[model samples]
Target: METLATTEIEEDVDRISHLPDFIIHNILSRIGLWDWIRGGKEHHSQLLRLSVLSKKWFNLTASFPYLIFRIDHFHNVSRLNFFKYVEYATSRFCHHHNHVTAHTFKLSTTLREPAELDIVIKCVELVLNKGVRVLSIDILSVLGVQRYRLPNILSTVSMLESLAINGCYLPSSFMVNALQFKSLIRLKLQYISIDDEVIKYLNTSCPLLQDLEIRRCNGFKIVCVTGHQNLQNVTIAHNTQVERIHIEAPNLSELWLDERRTMQMNLVSCKKLRKVTYFGDLLPNSNSGFLSNFPFVDTLMLDTKCNNLKLSSHSLRTLVLLSNYDLEDIEFRTPNLASMYSRKYLFTMQPSVVSDSTHLKASMHCNPYGYIDATWFQKLRQFLDKKNGLEVLNLHIRTTCSLEKRDLEKLKAIELPPYELEHVQLQLDTQEESSAHRNFVDAVFWCCRPRSLILKSSSPLIDFEEQSDIVKFTHEKLLEQEDQSRTKIQIVPSSSCEAQIHLSDLKSLSKALPSAEQIIKFIKEEA
Candidate 1:
């Protein structure tokens, strides 16, 4: 019987080995090699053991198209050993699969010595020579260390399609008269110092470039991208030195600008622009007419302190406003607006949406440092009143003060809205557990009762005891209402699909709930 079992097992292994090359490669790709790199040596050994199955399996593993070398993964090894491991891995892979091209190669490492950078550059060159299509390199070095300069050899890689370089430097000298990237489609540069000349070079040379992202990079004051017919998406964010950006891409669809200070932005002939996310002050004289340039804009996110900004977009679908305390008024004339999200300090002027769309979902985030009285709730109610045809409301509150018993009574006395929302989400961030939590919960129910209530806390310092106290208090309050009204409240863990629990079973299962970020759903069913 043992001999027969051994033969059967061998036969089964042989059958798996005989699978087609593409099937075997597909299976290997789904093994999640990137996830296994974060595990211990035992898990890595298990993955390595797959190579011993057969000569074909060993060769297949050696020729794997995705190569990732993250130095942080080898935390147990010394710096010298880390360098040696990377060198050995790159050389071995290249030697074994010299004829086969890799699909992607990612390298992330901290550079302490100049020699380490040379090794990285050599490895990148080897991969590029092998026609790797997608490459991502992230280098972190000492504060005063010289930044990694882009090698001239990079311009020769015609097969490279997507490239991302972080914490590196791009010199204008390297880009001057450099050859074009015929196949390059996407480029992302972060934490680098690049100038306008390099940007101009890329715009003119790389005809196939579609997506470009420049974040937290200095040295260039003006980004003038003109006549890029193939450019589709552009993002230039958080650059302190950038003063003006002028783009005339006719095919551009999305543009995101998140500058710290005010900058002049000019968009011409971008009739296909669908979304614009601006996080800085608009021009002093700019008003509603500024949006006329983007006639087809579907989504707009403005995070500026510009006061009295009037946004009138007929085709706008989604709108997000994040304002400083200084912002006073914003009037929206978007009749087709579908979603609106606002985050700001309390008492700021809420945006007035004139949309008639019934699918409008509104989210409000308020962080009031002072006490919460009846006035705040009244203001919230008035804000919700302007959103016509509103379906769902999500409210996030972060406050230091809790509603006292006296204030709670005043809040409850206010008349509730006649129409209930389809869903209401309440994310509370408070300091501690207090008697006022119950009052706050009651105040929320008075404002706008919804058929479904989702509750969670966004406080990072909150412990399990505090989270449980809030959950228990909420459950008790909902149960008390269930006894008098026809509404039946069913509690379920939002992260789980298990059977819903009755009100009486909550205390027993309270300890089973996840802490801090746990979300509990309360479905109100009319009996």
Candidate 2:
């Protein structure tokens, strides 16, 4: 019987191996082995293991068309051995698919010696010769090591569509000609030092370019992106040395700027802009409303320090407010807004919404240092008011101290208006004693009446025994109010399905409940 079963499994494997090349490739791609955006060392190893099944599988893996090599993947091997492995692997692939046009090739490693750098350049040239369209080379820089200089041979590849270079230095002569990047559509440069002239060259050279990103790069003071009618998305973030940015892309739709320092921005012609993310002090200093420049923007994310900020936009749909420490008041006049997320240190106030939309989902993350008082609950009630018609509310409360009995009394003394939500989730991170857990639950219930309360731990380091005690206390408290409120408690266990059981059933399955780490893992997976 064992021999018969083994023969059947081998026969099934043989049948799958005889499939057409396109069918096999499609099957492998479904596992994310050939995806440029998904594959990693694990996927590569899985592909190699699959190749050992048969010669047809080996050939298919060699001609996979998407290749990625990273030295960090081989941490147990020496640097020289890693390079030799790369050379041997690439040589085998190139030999098998001599005339095939590779779709993408990515190499990420650190080079301490000049010979290693030369070998990397050679590998890049070899990929280009194979007509690889998408090339990404991320050379990590050591503290005292010289930065890698981008070889000029890349400029000769007119068929390249997407190119990404990190931790490299681009000389002035590189990409100087306008005819170099004729087919390039996407370009990303990070941790690079390139002059302003090279940027100007790309601005005029790559007419078909649609996406451009320059992050944490230096040696360029002013960025003037103009005359690219096809450009749609532009991101310039964390480049503190950039003093001025002037963009005139008529077809541009998305722009993201995350600079710590103040800078001048001219986006007068970006009328088609639909989303804008600004993270700096540029908003408070602007003479006019910064959002007025892009009237068509539907999504906006702001991380700045402003006291009384007012946003009035007709096309706004989504808003994300992050790290606004000095924010006191916010007035929104977005009639079409549908979703809003506010993540900050503390919540002293909520945005005053003057919209006609009845459907809105709001999520908030509040990190309080010492303790949560009644005033915080009052502000939270104002934020989650019934007038907003919020469909769901996800609240993450992370506090360093526990709630006292007096705080709980004060919270209960303040009568909050009745507002029932469709779904309410509370992620708690506190160091309160097991006795104070009941007071914390009472304070939370006083703020809002949630039909279903989803409870989970916010911090992974929380003691499992203590967290289990908290959960048990919360279950008992909710059961005491079950007759009056009919609220159901949803406890998300780590390895099992979400059990929405009553406190009366705790004795029957108390040992089966998840630990703190399991709850955190489940929360992350859900997120």
Clash number for each model = 0, 0
Report the C-alpha lDDT of model 1 over 1-527, residue by residue, as the tens digit: 99999888777776767887667877777866554433335546756667555557666766777778787786566788777766766777777877778788888888988888888778877777777888898888886656676676777787888989998765344456765578899999899877778888777767888999999888889999888889999999988699888888889999998996777767857889999998777667777666775778888877776557678878887877777432235555666676665565442222332122344354443445456666777666665665555556566666777777787787667666633666766777777464565667777776775667788766432455555666677766555545546667778776563767766676545655665566778876775
Per lDDT, the best of the predicted structures is 1
Q: Which candidate has the highest TM-score of all?
A: 1
The residue-by-residue lDDT of candidate 2 on 185-215, one tens digit each, is: 9999998887788788888879899999999
Superposed by TM-score, candidate 1 places the C-alpha of residue 449 at a distance from the truth, in angstroms, of 17
TM-score, cand. 2 vs. native: 0.63
RMSD of each: 9.8, 10.5
Pairs with backbone N, CA or C atoms under 3 Å apart (clashes), candidate 1: none
Clashes of 1: 0
